[model samples]
Target: MKKLILLLLTAILALGCTACAARPYTPAGEPTGNAALDEQVLALLQELCDPKADLVTNLGAVYDFLCTGITYRATLADTSGGFTDELTDSLALELLQKRKGNCDAQAALTAVLLRRMGCEAQIVQGTFLRADDPEPVDHAWVYAVVNGTDCWFDPLYGGHFAENPRDYFMADDSRMALTHQWDAAAD
Candidate 1:
């Protein structure tokens, strides 16, 4: 728990800048930004970013919204012979339109929303451990600052269809280590 707190603090402090430091939302095949897509993102951001709410609460709302709102499209690999790669920008845009994507799309959307909401955030690629599963699995999620504390969130968990969704929110890195690890090969 202490280690988790430390990691959270480190991440929050590192990304303390108010403006999200990220590339513009120009993904793979898309050349120009779509107004509808921009509105879609802004609409969601407005709903999630409440000035009256504390940053952590607002961020939690964002996490919950994406998890519950987006549909999970599973595949065997990151590429899936399409635009599902964890690091693809195009996947994010596609997710905004399709409303269904695998971990890559979900994570990309989560990171984009966090940045738009004024949190410095990024998507992370990693391996995950499930209790019933025999081995680790590749996955993607988001890391961002919440209420000045660094936090990790798995937006895919939103649609994980589990009873305890909060179990996946604002996790300390150590706790996450039980089920999550950064994929070195993804780099």
Candidate 2:
């Protein structure tokens, strides 16, 4: 309990020190609120990854699991105000138990699961240009680095973005910049 809190606090402090609102470190896979829920998420993540698989293979499998498993349902019914900010507060367990959440929840859960599987993952928060709107709206997604390559994953958007889900899977930075305006995550 203490270690989880400390890790969370450290993550917060690290983000605080950054010039912009970077991804706050929320160590997942640790039992913070509900142990049962934690185990369930862990088990599901484990089920997704095959030990015999390579790193990219494991990441691809996990990314596919999250995109297919969760739906883009906001925790709050009122989305007129753009619920991304509020929904970001829910921890990974809550997102899993509920089985639906905004981009923030999906990305956070993805990052945690990837980290548990030994992939370097972090949540990236910023604005996303929704086609319906002229301006970018607050959004979050996962950024995982493997073999010196940065791969972007947005399980929320991954749901309906393309007939070929891999279109959004491990997207390169140049492609993501087209619609995503990342808020500087670090100093």
Candidate 3:
């Protein structure tokens, strides 16, 4: 009887540790100082993400919103400038407002949302080769450190009209190298 009790206690301890490790996500990073922008992001999170789900599931929800909710367009704003802070901020806001953007805008918006969700994420400007295209084209995607593992999220290519968009979510370097080409040392 005492041995059975000890085993039960050990199992309870393990479960408790796991639950503690999966603490809820809190908003991180310096606020944009624009209340509207911050509010918009939070609203989107409320609509799209399940607060009780696992981290990867929540990330997938955001990716799904980007892939299906947002439309892809090479807007003048995307070509007019580089990824300056103002440009990135405007692009992210535009993506939420207009739901239209190119790869740059998609990546910028993804990074913004992920950062707001307290995930360490960044935009990666690189090249991508489609199976039908003759040459690789300039592209932008997201690189995130998720749960201490380096993961890649490409909404532009993986989400837009993809048969399996989830494949792009939380992908590692090896899996992303199938089409994405970027300087690993840069980010």
Q: Against the unseen true structure, what C-alpha lDDT does each candidate score?
A: 0.67, 0.68, 0.81
Per-residue lDDT of 86-114 in model 2, one digit per residue for the tens? 34334566777877877767876776676
Better of 2 and 3 by TM-score: 3
lDDT of 1 by residue, 1-187 (tens): 9999999998897787544554332211222254555567776656565655666677788778877877667633355343332334566677878788888778777777666666766678777877688797877787777657777888685358345777678877675666678853642
What number of clashing residue pairs does each candidate have, in the order they appear? 1, 0, 0
Clashing pairs in 1: 67-158
How accurate locally is residue 86 in candidate 2, as Cα lDDT from 0 to 100? Answer: 30
Query: What is the model-wide C-alpha lDDT for candidate 2?
Result: 0.68
As for candidate 3, its clashing pairs are none
Per-residue lDDT tens digits for candidate 3, residues 17-122, read 9987744345544556567677788778878776678777888888988888887788667543457767777888888888998998898888888888778888
Question: Who is ahead in lDDT, 1 or 2?
Answer: 2
Model 2 residue 143 lDDT score: 81
**Model 1 compared with the native: what TM-score?**
0.67
Candidate that beats the other on lDDT, 2 or 3, i.e. the better one: 3
The C-alpha stretches of model 2 lying farther than 4 A from their native spots are: 1-38, 76-90, 185-187
Off by over 4 Å in 1: 1-36, 75-88, 161-163, 183-187
